[model samples]
Target: MSRVTVQLNGRDFTIGCEEGQEAYLRELAGSLDKRVSEISGQVGQIGDLRLLLMASLILVDDLKESDRKIAELEGQAQRLRHENHGAASLQAEARNELTAHLTRLAERMESFADTLEAAGDDSDGDGGVPAPDTSLAEAGA
Candidate 1:
């Protein structure tokens, strides 16, 4: 345990805290003293208890406001996260759909190529008619 002497309203008070928290305690005391002094100035040196009470209330109000803001920010963050997750899912679904479409188109093109190849083979060997002359231009020249 550690003891720290803090001056508030021109009075020194001893406070006890954990060993490593002496500095933190002193800092808190300093802030409280400043608040009390401000209140005293406004209210003209009212009783120490009343000044302290008013300061405590003000501090509590500030803390509550801060808590509310933090909660609001956290809610916004959660909503944004949900929206991003939905967007990512939509993108993945679109990618999958595109992949399936491309696969089908490739299969169709392969079938068309096979059909054309079969027709060419038939013209060359399976039919009784002679193949069309591809070298007619050269022969004339």
Candidate 2:
């Protein structure tokens, strides 16, 4: 255990906490002192008990508000996760469609290449279609 001296309402008090929690205890006391100061200024030297009670209530209200905000943020995060799942499905579908289109295009290109190769094989060595024999026409000219 550890003991910490903290100032609240202009009075020093010794408080006990776990060994590693002295700093935390002091911090809480500081916050409480700040709240007490604020209330004292407004209410003009109220009793210590009343001042401490008011500060405690204020801190509890703040805690509740924080909890509410946390809950709201968690709900929003869950909704985003759900939306992302749907988006992932849509992306997969798009990928599948693109793959199918590419497959068909590849098949058509292969067929065209085969046809060109066949034509090239049938052509004469000059890489062109054979011209008609013109020997008789040239003799007349």
Candidate 3:
């Protein structure tokens, strides 16, 4: 551990941090001191305890605002995920419906083939020249 002395409101305080984290700790301390000085200057003749309490309140408010922003972003992400899920489900349902409709069309084409075959047979019995059944699909032909 390493110790750093930080002066806030004209008082020196020592805080501990890991050796490599000195720069970050120092920067954090500097920022806090700046905030305290800014506040103390506006509210002159403030007690040390009251000054610290006010600083704590300011820091806590900042933390809370950061947390609130994070929560809002998380909610946005979840809503987007929900919308994507709904769209995917709708696409799947559409594909299934299209498949069913195509199958029905194929069945109707097969029924038409049977009717044409019967009509050809009837025409032959009546001694009429049978017109060609040119409408047969390649697969059925």
Candidate 4:
């Protein structure tokens, strides 16, 4: 065990802790002393017990408030996560719809291209224009 001297409300006292925990104990004492000092400033020179009680109450109130804030923030985080999942689902649905539409459009374009190619095959090579009949030319001659 290690002994540490701490001051609270202008009085010095010795406290004991494990060797490695001396610093942590000192830190806790410092926090208590600071709270007591604040209480003293507000309500001057109250007895030691009353001062310590008021400081402890204040610290407990602060701890409760911090816990409440943490819970509120956690709720917000969960709600945001749910919203993000919904948005991602919606985006995936939209992409699928767009992809299906594009595939149908591509099929229609390919059918049109096949029809044009068949028409071209049925005519002369002059861009689907028929050739002049040789019998008609001979008759004219």
Clashes of each: 0, 0, 0, 0
TM per prediction: 0.83, 0.75, 0.73, 0.81
Model 3 misplacement above 4 A: 117-141
Tell me the lDDT of model 2 at 82: 94
lDDT of 4 by residue, 1-141 (tens): 889998898899998888899788889999999999988999998899999999999999999999999999999999999999999999999999999999999899778655655665677676655544557445542
- Tell me the tens digit of each residue's lDDT in model 3 across 35-121: 888888999748888887898999999999999999999999999999999999999999999999999998998787777777776
Pairs of colliding residues, candidate 4? none
Model 1: runs farther than 4 Å from truth? 125-141
Question: What are the lDDT scores of the predictions, listed in order?
Answer: 0.85, 0.86, 0.84, 0.86
Order of the predicted models by lDDT, top scorer first: 4, 2, 1, 3
Off by more than 4 A, model 4: 124-141
lDDT of 1 by residue, 72-139 (tens): 99999999999999999999999999999999998997786566556556785757645445474234
Model 1, TM vs. native: 0.83
User: What count of clashes does model 2 give?
Assistant: 0
For model 1, the local distance difference test gives 0.85
Candidate 3: pairs in clash: none
Model 3 lDDT at residue 141: 51
